[model samples]
Target: MKPRLPQLDRPVRMPSRSRILAAVIMLAVILGPFVGHLLGAGHGQAATPVEPLPLDSLLRQAEDQSPQVLRQLLLALVMSLCCTAIHLAVTVLVVVSYESHSLMAWASRTPLGRITLIAGTAMVTFLAMFVEILSWAALYLQQGAILPVEEALYFSSVTFASLGYGDITLDLPFRLLASLEALVGILMAGWSTALLVAVIQKCLALRFHRTDHGSDPTTATNP
Candidate 1:
């Protein structure tokens, strides 16, 4: 007799309601400040003026202060890695939860359902990115690199998006961190895009498979 192989169709474990509630609370904590910052934008006391410096001047300063730049770069890299890991975790959690609950099977049955799935995934991706930006903003605020909560959030958002609107700028010593954030943002954006594509492909495949086999595409044996 041949040895039994592990089953590929083993049931996925859905997260409990308590786990889902915890995840919701965590998202609220991460995104609350951003919502508050937007709502209270004009009501708050004026942020102290931060003069923007020319890029060339900032570069020269960084060159002259190699040790400080190196330290800041290392810190930025560490933060970027942390943010990436957090983003990946969020994406995996969402995908797994959806799959475990057979949401993919339900969504694959209709065009509208597929659209909703894609839209929901996009929103989650945006939220994850915002959470990362807020983390960097919190770091900037804590370090006294940007004093006002609103300004820190704004600077971090623009920096992370690589917008560089020139309306807000970090000091020379901390400027390298902004560059790192921009790089991370680009990578995360690409990652999110790829995730969306993969999700769409899965949905399409499941839809076709269910149509042909007359079986629930997401069905699995219970453990």
Candidate 2:
């Protein structure tokens, strides 16, 4: 009788405390504004609902000179920088995961693996943008620009996507934030696209290399 080799089961890796804490902090930043709004309502102090101002009012507010505009611009600058830093950090983490986990090898072995990698990379990018948008929504609420947290977040999402639905409008001071967020969204989308393309290229090259090295049988063999 032939001897059978024993199979070893792969160990599942549990998330470390630091990683779990980081995730919690990310979620808190994303949902804290909404939670606070709910708490305020429960305490018998409901936030004033946001109402769109008339065009004349909006234009007048826009033309009025104030230091609030400067403050808002500075805030926008800081938030943009923070979002950029986070996006870059996420890119670094993705690249690190790919290398550490030998994702290229897995990708080269199967088309499904490559697709999974692409989907995962995209999800990470989406999550990074969500956090940034939520931060801006929280800031808008804090600045009292928008009355309701949900309205602020809705505005943030619309502006981030550059949808410009115009159902809700911000005064000039806070409008600057929306403009900056739209620009950030465009830039981040470009960055993510580049990353996805690079990953695809790497995966394809890995497969080519394996075939050239005679490791993969799909390549044509020289007669």
lDDT of 1: 0.82
Give per-model TM-scores.
0.63, 0.63
C-alpha lDDT of all candidate models, in order: 0.82, 0.79
Per-residue C-alpha lDDT of model 2 across residues 22-138, encoded as one tens digit per residue: 999999999999999889887764456558799999888767745777776789889889888989998898878766434555666877876887788888888998998898899
| Candidate 2 total steric clashes | 0
- Model 2 stretches astray by more than 4 angstroms: 1-66, 216-223
How displaced is residue 45 in candidate 2, in Å? Answer: 48
Worst 10 residues of 1 by lDDT: 214-223
Off by over 4 Å in 1: 1-64, 98-101, 211-214, 219-223
How well is each residue in 1-223 modelled by candidate 1, as lDDT tens digits?
Answer: 9999798787889899999999999999999999999868745544655588999999998688998878888888888888889778878876785656467667757878878877888888889989999999998988789999999999999988888798988887788888888898888888889988877776677667767887766673220
Error of 1 at 178 (Å): 1.1
